[model samples]
Target chain A: MRAIVLAEGAPYAPAPLSASHPLPPPSPDTTLVTIHAAALNHRDVWIRKGLYPKIVPGSVLGSDCAGTDESGRRVLINPSVNWASDPRAPENPDIYGMLGLLPLPGTLAEQVRVPSRLVHPVPSHLDFVHAAALPLAGLTAYRAVVTRGEVKPGDKVLITGIGGGVAIFALQFARALGATVIVTSSDDSKIARAVKLGAAAGINYKNLDWRKAIGAHGPFDVVIDGAGGEGVAVYIKSMRPGGNLVVYGSTAGSEVPLQIPIVFLKNINIKGSTMGNEAEFKSMLELVSKHEIVPIVSSIVDGLERAEGAFDMMKNGNQFGKLVIRVHEKHHL
Target chain B: MRAIVLAEGAPYAPAPLSASHPLPPPSPDTTLVTIHAAALNHRDVWIRKGLYPKIVPGSVLGSDCAGTDESGRRVLINPSVNWASDPRAPENPDIYGMLGLLPLPGTLAEQVRVPSRLVHPVPSHLDFVHAAALPLAGLTAYRAVVTRGEVKPGDKVLITGIGGGVAIFALQFARALGATVIVTSSDDSKIARAVKLGAAAGINYKNLDWRKAIGAHGPFDVVIDGAGGEGVAVYIKSMRPGGNLVVYGSTAGSEVPLQIPIVFLKNINIKGSTMGNEAEFKSMLELVSKHEIVPIVSSIVDGLERAEGAFDMMKNGNQFGKLVIRVHEKHHL
Candidate 1:
């Protein structure tokens, strides 16, 4: 198997592309997957830089992929594992971790082995590049927007940092659910791009009064935010009483400054959500298939040799959608 | 009717024991209740000190009351109004405000007029004073512990500020639900009182390492918190993944400092809860009746003439239970 493994070095460069890797041993519960396309995520960037916890230097690095299984079934891998079917949380701690990290091999390879239960058929409308983009970000958005937020038709939904792959998916999913989506970003071009992608409104967080913009579009019904900082105060203020604030990541800062009284008085719910359970992954795929929702692939590099450029694009933080790697031609067996 | 009315003064003292006030006008949707007893809350103290919003001069100022209706029905008033049975939230904002404020008459009076729908039968186990304590605090606790927290049997529960009427109620309600209850208080004596009242364990928040004590009892499944500030960090840190931290008040500080990443990874739910709607109020009364739960009353003043003393005790915060005013004999009928 040719794989993308972390390279141990002084600077800790994640050379996620390796030509020499041993094929995984066969297991009764596991099946081999031949990856046709894989996508870059923030997790890949962190693992490559050796910033993620419990880093195994030789571990593969990727969480999202669209590929084929041994029985010749078209599939997409659910990177989140050990969650059982519990929507509330994983059955156990630590074991309910994502793929592409220690102990679990990643999908940025010609072949990978995974538990059979974590595999699902790819949405027929999507090609491998687009299908690769769906596994991680789409599942996250499904849980955050559809499951946690419970966004309804005509609901006003606000998603922050529209440049991230998850935020873009959230916009699409919320829109697919018939919600009026609003977006926030520091980049006006990204805001414009989000508007083109169906956002009802967009605001630049850099504004001295960025919060003022929210009042016009919504006292939003559901707010999907990953930027936790002083910025949260405005989200708290702008939400309707009993609104849900679903969070999956914290790219901006870890400390959230919240007005405690408002949360109590407004009946607000702030939930911490992450990569979802396997059931949610299937539901995510169902929604994607039913809506013919194509994964937003911002850029696709030709092969694993250009993996550095893809990872760099993710690291630089300006990409608006998923960055995919074409591992093989769609016709590959 | 003699009502406890707000005295229009510079240092606005709540004359919560008016000798003579006009009786509330009769209305088609309203029913008159002859007050036998009323309980003092932190809300009463805030209104008395003129610290609460929208104070109307000469308006009555109390929330929890147990009395007899015009039809001689033994009743307790649900102070939360206009919520229209939606367990999620009030159908509209502002109109869902509690009693004892402007536009709504308070319970601290010889007779109070309220919507007939907000009146319910008092639990047979409690006398007037205890029943008075049940309305506001018990409803808040029932919503926090039972509704939002959804505490199940064997769930470990944490209630902070056991001195508070609501927290005490939460402790009792969670225990009655077959949960193992833990309480936190700054006063050792209050912790002792909470233990006597059924807490499995108690920790004094005054201790510099208060959270360390929690490790022995649990990583709590549900934490009912009223005091929010830097202290919330420890509460968040000490909860299980998918734990519910229900906030109904912010007595310590309004700003809560949260570790956003932990919230997302642990899938913690931070929800703001207040007094429940009509349906939850009925359910609360049912639970109280079924369990024969008694409100922990600290002191019952002989009459409204000593209402100041009861209000002062609530403001000083050393009392371990509710301070109530006995307006009339328990057998007023």
Candidate 2:
């Protein structure tokens, strides 16, 4: 089996690619997934560049994928695996699943082994390219907007950062939930595009006071911040009392100076969410199927050979939505 | 009428008491409460010293008090008064009423005018000193432990600091809610007292590896941090996944370095709560009446004349519970 294995942490310029990997047989309770398409995430880029200190030399870096099992069952892989089972966990799978950060191997190869329960049946209407994009980013947005944010119809939601996969999904999910979606983008074009994608308003964070612009929207019930920093504190101030701030990714920076008194005075709730639980995943998929909300696929690279290029495009910020790697030939499959 | 007034922000010794002023009359829709007792909180001390920049000079400083209205009805004053009302707020006469901060004068005076709705019938069983202690610290603890922490039977709760008014209330509240309470205290005698007050375990945080001691208790479901600093980050790490950390006051100083990834990975929630809402106040009063939870009153000083002495006791950390100022004699009417 051909796999894009990183031997060492190096810049994408060296274009290191290796081809002599053997596909390991599935262990007990593990299902072997023949990868058809895998999507790139910012985490993968960070993992590849060794920004994640735990990444070893032999780590396979992708977390989101869709493919078929040995029995020819189509599925989308849920990539978060936990060793300790929480009874309250949404998915009570028999074995650990694909949580890319831990000891579990990721899905950037031709074939990957995951716990059977982690694989959800993809709707027949959705193809592998779109299905592959739904696990990590989609679940993150789902958890942020629905599960954690508790966004409901008539609620106003403010999503920070446009063009990022999670932000785009958040906009669509908020819209599907009947919320008035507002988004922020540094790029003018991205703001326009976000508005076309059902956003009630889009703020150019680069040119205007995003806090004042978002304040004009006045007291959003929920604010989803992908950009962590002082910006999160600013957004928190824009929420009405009892409003929620769901923080997932902090792409901008992490050290945010916060005024603790304001948080207490306003009675604001700040919740940090990662990707969604399995129940949330199913709920999102159900919404997608019902609403026919297709994930915005920015670009689909032809083969696994161009994995480096796709990652480069992501790093250079030239891509909008998800960049998928089609690993297998349709005729061959 | 006599009042403890700070003509300017200065040291306690330099700040003199003013006694020539007459009691202000009540306005329409408002009642003049002849304050029978006022409790000294850190907020009062901060306000007097002008540590709180928002408080203007000559502003009376106490936020918690119990007194008799012009109609001679015994009442506990709600301190939080925001001018803007949320229509969705619950409907109980005491459900959304508070007098001291905004839209109302501060409570440290011989007589203060409050909207009639801001008054609640004090539990007939509790005296003025106990009722005064109940509003600010008791309500903060009630909201933090019950509303924010959602403590339940068999849940393990970690409370940092023990001798302060809120921490004492938290200890009582957590135990009443059937949670196993663990507390941290620097004072050895305070630890012993906390245990007697229902703390299952106590850690002297002055010692190193306090986290290890806390970790030995396994993961806490809720960690209430009143002492802020790098110590809170340690407490946050001690929480189980999906656990909540309710921060109400920061006595240890505010700026603390945080690891953002730990927050996301553990799915921890950090909520800042001040004194609770009007509903919480009424609910706490009911709990006090039903459960017969008597607030620990350390000392009750006489009127505005000795108010400075009570404040001094609170500032010097000599009091185990609420240091209350008895404003007037019961037979004065």
Candidate 3:
């Protein structure tokens, strides 16, 4: 099978996935998927650069995929495993990990095998490219906004770092749920784009007084923070008493300094969340389908051979949404 | 009415409350109570040094109390108002203020008047001193341990700085709910006393590596922290994935530095809570009655005249449990 493999020294290579079927499913309860499209995430860039943990040379490298199964069902795979029964956390976290690492075949290949339970029908509104874009970022945003934030109709939501795929999804999902969405981005154009995409307001956090500026618009019900509280004091200050701040990721360094007294005084809740469970993955897809929310595909490169181009675009960090690799032409199983 | 009023410059005076009908209940639905006992909180200490917000000089200055109401019902005041109908927060935070300041008379008095809704039946097991200790600290702990932490039976729980009133109540409440409670205090004597009081284990956080030392006992399901996360990284490191870290106050300085990545990667939650709402206060009382959990009272000063001594002891922070002022000899109403 053709796939993008992590090669020795030179990094990502288009190679034949061999060595006695290392990519094959370990169980009979699993099905093979002919991947039509796969998306690039920061994990792929990190693995390629030897920045990620437990990297295996010659393993196919991609976590998000849209494909056709043996039953010819249009599907997208849940990127995680070993957490089907537990909604709060994986039942056994020691064995829990996302796909694309060793012991789990990546979706960058022509075909990949996975547990049948990890496969779900793709939202009816999306194609292989957009569906491939949805799983990892969409599920993460869903957990932060709906599951953790408890965003209701008329709730005020603030999503930070607007251009990233996850933040964009948070904005769209919060809006879909009838929330008044606000976004923060250092780039004015990104903020403008977000405002155009139905956000009630946008703030370029580059300004020294952006935090103070933000307070005028809020007393927000929920703030979706991708970075930890580098601006935590400001975030909590803008929150209503008893408001919730759901943090999904942290780009900030080791110690995120926060004004802890405000949290004590204001009755604020700070929850840390990440990749969601299987049930949340299903709910995310349902929400996408019901609201006709399309995954924002910032850039797409054709052919499995051109997967690195998508990776380069993602690494450059200017893309507003997902970077996808259209792997197969027709993918007729 | 004889009450402990905040005297100009001198501080915490047991002066006779003069001014025409100032201590009388403003509404027809309110009741007047003859206070048998009153308790001191850190807020009382902060207000004494002129450090707390919205200080109303000459106002009676205490929050926790147990007394006999006009109907001969033995009761304790809820300490807060405008939040009776709102479970999550005060309906109008602008009007939301606890007793012990102007508009709401302090509990350190011969008699206090309040809305009927703010008064609750005292636990059958507790006398005036213990019941007086229960309201503020007990309500705060109940929110941190049960309402926010969602601590379940058999859960391993961590309660930090266990010598203080709120932390001690958290220790007892978590234990009463069938959780394995562990405590941390700088004083070895305090830790020993907490273990004797029913904690499963104790660690003296005075040790330089107490944070790492704590890991051997847990993988805690819930951690009740009175101080904000000075040891947040260590706390989250010892938390089970999807565990909750509830922060109720910050004894540490203004800024709390936390390892943000661990929170994001571990699926940990850090919530900020203070005094609970009316429903939570009722629930705390019910739990106390059902379990016969007595609020630990360390020192009892007799009569409103000696109220300043209770304030001084709380400020010094040498006590292991609540410092209570026994306001009156048994009152027949």
Give me the candidate number with maximum TM-score: 1
Candidate 2, overall lDDT? 0.77
lDDT of 3 by residue, A1-333 (tens): 577778866554434333233446456999888888999888888888787678888777889999888898989999988777465677889889888888678888778889989999988889999999998899889989988898999999999999898999999999999999999988999988899888998988889989887899898999999866466667888999889888887774546777767876777888877888888898888889999998888988888767666777888899898899888745332
| Better by lDDT, candidate 2 or 1 | 1
TM-score of chain B of 2: 0.89
Compose the digit string of candidate 1's lDDT tens values, residues B176-231. 99999999888898889889988988898788777688766678899999988666
Scored by lDDT, the top model is 1
Chain A structural similarity (TM-score) per candidate? 0.96, 0.91, 0.93
- The lDDT of model 1 is 0.86
* DockQ versus reference, model 3: 0.73
Question: Cα-based RMSD of the predictions, in order?
Answer: 2.0, 4.5, 2.5
lDDT per residue for candidate 3 within B1-333, as digits (tens), equals 567777676544444333232456456888887889899999987887778768878778789999888888899999977676555566788988888887778887778888888999999989988999999899889989988899999999999888999999999999899999999988999999999989988888779889777899899999898766466667778999889998887785567677777777787888877888898888999999999999999999987777667777887998999999887654222
Alpha-carbon error at A117 in model 3, in Å?
Answer: 0.4
List the candidates ranked by lDDT, beginning with the highest: 1, 3, 2
Segments in model 1 whose C-alpha atoms lie over 4 Å from true places: A14-16, A329-333, B14-16, B329-333
* Model 3 Cα shift for residue A169 (angstroms): 1.0
lDDT of 3 at A160: 92
For model 3, the superposed segments whose C-alpha errors exceed 4 Å read A10-26, A252-254, A329-333, B10-26, B85-87, B329-333
Q: Write the per-residue lDDT of candidate 1 for residues A94-186, one digit (tens) a residue.
A: 677888987998887778889999988998999889999999898898999987898999999999999888999999999999999999999
TM-score list, all predictions: 0.97, 0.84, 0.95
